[model samples]
Each structure stands twice: as C-alpha cells, then as structure tokens.
Target: MAIATFGLTNIHRRVDITEGGVLGMVLLLDHHFGIPPWALTTVLDAACYLLGWKVLGRDFLIRSGVATLCGAIFFRLWDATGPLLPNLSAQPLLAALLGGAFVGVGVGMVVRQGGSSGGDDALALVIAQKTGWRLSRAYLFTDLTVLGLSLTYIAPLRIVWSLVTVTVSSLLIDFVKTVGHSENRQKA
Candidate 1:
C-alpha cells in the first residue's frame, strides 16, 4: 500500500516530498550510473515502509499502503493519457491551474486516509515525530521548497503553474481531512 502512495500525492495538497528527495537523490544516482533506478527506489521505499510500520504503526501502514497503490495506479493512467492532452505551455496559467488542481485533489484523498503517498511524506512523519510539528505545515514547507527548487530547471511561469497546482492540491488534502474523513466515518 505504501508502495502505491509513492506514485500519487503532491505538495499543493499539503503532502510534500522533501525527504523523499533524499531518497530520490539515490534513485537519481542510480539513473545517472545506469543502474535500475526503480530497483533502488523500491528498496528504499520498502525500508521506509518498515520504519513506518515499526514506528508509526498499523494505521499508518494501512494508510500508506492504500495511498501508494492509488497513487501508482492513478499516475500510470494520467501518464498514459498525457499524449492526448494539448500543450499547456500555450497558456501556462490555465495549465498550471488545471494540473495542480487535479493533482491536489488526488493527493488530498491519499492524505485524508492517513497514508502518505511517498517521499517527503516519510520525512514529514519524521519531522512530526522528532519535533512535534504539525504534519500539514511541515508538508507545505517541504513542498514549497521543492517547487522553488523546481524553478531552477523549469521556467518561472511554469513554476507559477506548479504553485497553483500545489495550492489546489493542498486545499484538496485539507478538504479530505475536514469533509471526506468525517463522511467516511459516518458511513462506517
């Protein structure tokens, strides 16, 4: 389940991957060196899962598992459909808005279930555990940092688009916690 979460979720939804970057760096290295990056990432992800299970317990394990599965499946579908989409850069703002909003909602659902989708998600949990910081705030800060760093590679306007997406994502995650979870509980 945790494996699935890694495939989904984003910062705009208040779930960041800063710490995941640490692991990502390892994955990147594997890519750069011609090693199977996914292999390494999978191992790292598994280790993280174990850590979560040991420290964070069953709920987190379940949450992480479902989120990871959903993320992987959703992203694979999104990517498969990517070829059908038009050029977003023609109207960067609109692209960002739509992309971020969609990603945000998807991510929000993962978070609301109490499973981190991936990367900085584990870090956010670590921060929460070590310093008692609110996971939401930690996630936002980590994601913003990531988005800012992304600007170095992508254009400034594109960065803005990413931010819009992140905002929508965050809002969605919050909504999940506020409304979705409650409704789910009532249904149960």
Candidate 2:
C-alpha cells in the first residue's frame, strides 16, 4: 500500500506501533498543530508504570515498559521520516490503514502480555476488572472514544482509518494469544 502511494514500504512498518510509538505517531501526525504529545505520553507512561508495579507485577510491567519504549522510539523515527514521505492527502486511506494497524498491534501485544500501552488502555483494564466486562469489549469502548477525539485534529476519514487499523491490530493480537494458549493446553 505504501509502495504504491509513496514508494515507501518500510516507513511505518518497521516502527512496531507500540503505545509509545503510537504516542510518537500522534505527535508526529499532529506536530503541525503544536499538540502536547509528550504531556500525554508522560501521563500515560506514568499510568502504565504504576499499573505495572502495582496491578500487573514486575515481570509484566517490564514487558509493557519494553513495548512502550519501543513504540515511543519508533514513533520518533517515523516522525523524523515524515518529511520524506508524502503528506496524508497523498494517500490518506493507506496512511490511516497502516497507521491504525501499526498502533493496534502494539496495543494488543502489550495487553496480551499482561500489560498496557497507557492512558485509556490502562483505564480500560481497570474498568474491565471492576465491572467484569471482557477486555476486548473494554478496548473497543476506549478506542471509540479515542477515535472521536482524533477527529478534532485529523480528517473524519482519517479517524475512521485509525479505527480500522486499531481494530485489525487488536484482533490479530488476540488471535495469536488465543492460539498460543490453546496450543499450550493441548500440550499439557
């Protein structure tokens, strides 16, 4: 998709779209508007950090930390590279699809590993635990809210693409985790 649009295939593909990465992407994408992405990212990271220590224990927190850091770093790289690529209007749909998929996968991996990317993701888990709803459902609710907020900075269509990307990413993560669990049970 990227190749056809910008002749760039590895731009966002290599970033890994973890929570931090997504935060970075959010910053990069919205840099023109002077949005305070670091402020948000810091708060989210603190939340994840606290959750990692208190709610999820050290082991899981470590994994989440790794994912968050990876996401953030990759996001920065993507931001730096943004100038080289065509702007969103060049291929908005493709950008949205890939962007959403990248971030969603990052979120799923962190969550599946018993951690979170941050912000509403952590809040979603807390809500799920307290309210007894499924995690995926909680994630969906959270994503919907985020998608709505995204519309303020981006085109309506771009917001939709982000939603699609996240949805696909989450599904893929869950599928992998579920299969792994099933395989483990069979071995047992």
Question: How do the predictions measure up, each by TM-score?
Answer: 0.61, 0.59
Compared with the true structure, the alpha-carbon lDDT of candidate 1 equals 0.54
Per-residue lDDT over 1-188 for candidate 2, one digit per residue giving the tens place of the 0 to 100 score: 12211222232433322222235345544555666876656765576567546765677667666665665565566456655644444564566566555445555556766766555456656655656655555566666665666555556654555566556655554443445663223210
Q: Provide the lDDT at 122 for model 2.
A: 65
In order, the Cα lDDT scores of the candidates are 0.54, 0.52
Best by lDDT: 1
Instruction: Count backbone overlaps in model 1.
Output: 22
Q: Tell me how many residue pairs clash in candidate 2.
A: 6
**Residue 28 of model 1, lDDT score:** 45
RMSD to true structure for each model, in Å: 7.0, 7.2
User: What local lDDT score does residue 130 receive in model 1, on the 0 to 100 scale?
Assistant: 62
